[model samples]
Target: MSKRPYLIERYPPSDRFNHWFVAITFILVALSGLALFHPAFFFLSHLLGGGPWTRILHPFIGVVMFVAFLALALRFWGHNFLTGNDRQWLRQMDDVVTNQEEKLPAVGRYNAGQKLFFWTMVISILLLLITGILIWQPYFAPYVPIVLIRVAVLVHALSAFVAITGLIIHIYAAIWVKGSVGAMTRGTVTEAWTRQHHLDWYRKIKKGEIRGHDHY
Candidate 1:
């Protein structure tokens, strides 16, 4: 009988669920935020309901996105720390883009690009949360000074642009990397996929150094 390829669990069901939850909420929040951001995007408000409704729902949805992201961040916090290997991997960006895995360091579960993007999301979301509150109106903005609110508005818009840009790159990378989306959607990846993309992680898994199922 022919032997089947080995498979490895990448994300548990709970983590996958958490990640998808955040993704969904982020989409909603982004659309609603854009609607309130400019007249050009005002048409997007129809997605939530209308202008008045979009204004009301945007901040609430943003709160949900921030809280959900915090949960996801805490879960993956340990994996994202920058290391010497990661820095080296980053320095060899040309090799990475050219599929020269053998020329680069054996990457861990997350690569340098991923770690940097993770931190970008963290900082951007924190800024969005703080600034969103400052300009929230009725409940909070009324008590805040106008000058501070003005500053908060500019910061919030800039933060949102950063976050949206990061997310676009993140999505593109996921698509660029074969089998990456499958790791999250199916909660597993083939042994070959792991070995090629995250060789250090694969070695750790083989030695029982990391958590995950490895079986045929």
Candidate 2:
């Protein structure tokens, strides 16, 4: 019998590092942003060395996260773009929910859920960046009008809320899916996991001769 070919060399070293970078920075940003947003949320500032430091670091950390996440998203955006198969998969979500892979649709590197998440994150990040630039205190705000700054703050907070919620869901999905955390941490998943959760990706990996680090 032939040996099963190794697959799931999907996330590269930089890709994994980029993901953790964004994750960690976003946590810092969210906590700091919340601390400043409301008196009730002041406790969050404690995580970043009190309110004054949190305020100073929030924007800095946010910019770092945005740049890193933008690069990461650009790297994977083409692969994660929605396809016909993804639409079919969404329409047949019942099968996916039931884990009936044979009866469900064939997905590429990313599934419909993942594609949705990818776009959602992209839009919110863009919104956050634009709005943040508008109300960044000293730099851009002085040049912009007061009304616009108020509007930007509203949009910024709303986008942040949405982005945070999506991130929570993304984390939950990663945890729920077996072998997914391994991919992020170790930059690879098991052959069985590749075949089961992402068969189309598995096939392409084998055909394209992609193999995991462990294979090397």
Candidate 3:
């Protein structure tokens, strides 16, 4: 049999651009945030222009990351809807972890873990946004009560930590699965690659549409 070529643009240029946009802003926010968290982490402030600037820019960068991520997320959330099949896939996760992938169910475009990450991220991001706004000073803090701001700060910190942890997992997963990074890097994946990892998605890509995972 002739080898199938990798042809579909899995991420497309727009998606890749958004991914990088979120990535850079996330890094900036993380660094500046660490600087504000404690004296030991104050060295990170230097990257943003010393102590004062770090405080000024950290929230700004975080806002940028949040908006960019929200845009990217809205585009992809439909495919991530959970279903009976996804639950079954979760049950077979051990086979997935063991790389006995052939023994597991064929997911459309994303596996159970990927879908879980997607949903978890969405919730965490929403929490971060709402909480961040509450604690945001020179903006809404004066209008809001001090106790509410304190509560918002606690929620914001917790949600940011969760979102960051999920981001690390998302990145690590992209790296772990060969050809996965190619989707974000070059906006495409080989036909063979798509077929091997997401047979149903490959069929749709071959058919010329840019969507998959038609959940019921």
Candidate 4:
């Protein structure tokens, strides 16, 4: 008989639900926003109904995504703060890309790349929200100056580009790093996977220094 792998708790059910909720809303908002952005992507409007419906719903979906992301950001903000070890880890990008994690600094719950991505998402989303409001039709844009509205449109597009790029990289990394998706999907990870990817976190968990609501 094969030995069963030991499992470690990662995200709890609530966290996973929150993550997926944000993810779904993001997809909807991205598609609708794209439909409004360019004629090339206008076909996507059909997914939500038609161009008129897409225009009406995009901002509302964005608001929901923003609120959901706010809750997620608060939940994981503490884990994402950069540290001296994280700096060292960042300096070892060559090792990280080459599957030489052993040669790099011990990783925490998030690696340096993940932390940077988190902050990037935070900034991008904030800019998107601010600029989005400035250009929002019927509700807010009419009160804003035309010059600022133009600038806000530019900023909104740039922010969306950065965020979409970051999201692509995030998805690629999740797939490239085996077992990462399971943390969000199943809300747990194999002990061996945790030890290999986030050794410092694994040690803390083993030492009872990082107890959560869920037990391993």
Candidate 5:
């Protein structure tokens, strides 16, 4: 009989749910935000309701996304800190793009690029939240000076642009790397997949240093 393939848990159900929840809310917030950003994209407001309703719901959706993302960030932050190996990984960006992972240092649970992206999201979200409140209408903005509100609006737009751009790259990378999306969607990864992309993590599991839900 052929031996059953080994599988290792990557994300638990809670993590998966948190990730998808943040993702869905992010899409809603981004669409509604863009609608309010410029007339050219105003048609996107229809996704929420109409122009007035979109304005009303956009900030609320943003708050929900922020809260969900905070949970995800806290859960994964430990895995994403930069290390000596991660620095080396960043230095070998050419090899990364060339699919020459074998030529690089042993990768851990999260890679250098992934770590950078994680921090970028963290910073962007914080900036958006703070600046968003400063410019928020009918509540907080009234108490703030007009000049500060103007500055906040500018910063908010720039931060949102950076965040949206980063998200596009994140999504593209997920699609580019085979089995990555499965790790989030199915909550597990094949041993072969883990060994290839995150050999250090694979080794830890094999040595029983790192425990994961197992299937065979």
Candidate 6:
């Protein structure tokens, strides 16, 4: 019998669930938010019922997204801090885009790009939550001064733009990098995949410096 290919677990089931939860909530919130943002996108409101319902649900969904992301952020917080190698990886963007992995630094479980994306999501989500509250009508906005609320609206839209742009890149990168989506979906990646993409991480796994759900 052919032996099963050795695999390394990258994420446990809980982390995958946490990731997907935030992703689902983000889609919901983004749709509803866009519907409320402009007349051109008003048609998008149908996804969440209609304009009024979309308006009502948008903030609530955003709150849920923020909470879910917070959980994920806490879980991966340690993994995202940039190191010297990570900075070098960032500086070698040409090698990255050209798929010259050997020319670049050995990447960790999360590369510099991935770590930056993680922090971008964290900052944007936090800003969205804060500004979403400031401009929230009929609840907290009424008590706030008009000037601050007006400022909050602009900041909210700006932050949303940043977040949406980052998410697009994140999705594209996931698709561009073979086995990346699988690492999240199945919570494991082949040993070869790990070695090629994240050699440092692979070395640590071999040395037992890092533990995963399973190793073979």
Can you give the TM-score per candidate against the true fold? Answer: 0.97, 0.92, 0.89, 0.97, 0.98, 0.98
RMSD of each: 1.0, 2.5, 4.1, 1.4, 0.9, 1.0
Error of 5 at 69 (Å): 0.8
Clashing pairs in 3: 5-191, 6-190, 6-191
Clash-forming residue pairs, model 4 = none
lDDT of 1 by residue, 1-216 (tens): 989878899998999999999999888989899988989999999999999999998899889889889999999999999999999999999999998989999999999999999999999999999999999977899999999999999999999999999999999999999999999998899988999999999999989887777676
**Native-vs-model 4 lDDT?**
0.92
TM-score of 5: 0.98
TM-score for candidate 2, please give it.
0.92
- Per-residue accuracy of model 4 over 1-216 as CA lDDT, tens digit each: 876667888998999999999889988988889999999999999999999999899999899899999999999999999999999998888999999989988899999999999999999999999999999999999999999999999999999999989999999999999999988998888888888999999899889899632433
Ranking by lDDT: 1, 5, 6, 4, 2, 3
Clashing pairs in 2: none
How far does residue 68 in candidate 6 sit from its true spot (Å)?
0.7
Least accurate 10 contiguous residues by lDDT in model 5: 207-216
Give the alpha carbon lDDT tens digit for every residue of 1-216 in model 6.
888888899988999999999999999898888888999999999998998889888999999899999999999999999999999999999999999999989999899999999999999999999999988887899999999998999999999999999999999999999999999999999988988999999999899898853645
* lDDT of prediction 3: 0.80
Q: Tell me the lDDT of candidate 1.
A: 0.93
- The better-scoring model by TM-score among 4 and 5 is 5
- When 2 and 6 are scored with lDDT, the better candidate is 6
| Candidate 6 lDDT trough over 10 residues, lowest sum | 207-216
Backbone N/Cα/C clashes per model = 0, 0, 3, 0, 0, 0
- Supply the TM-score for candidate 3: 0.89
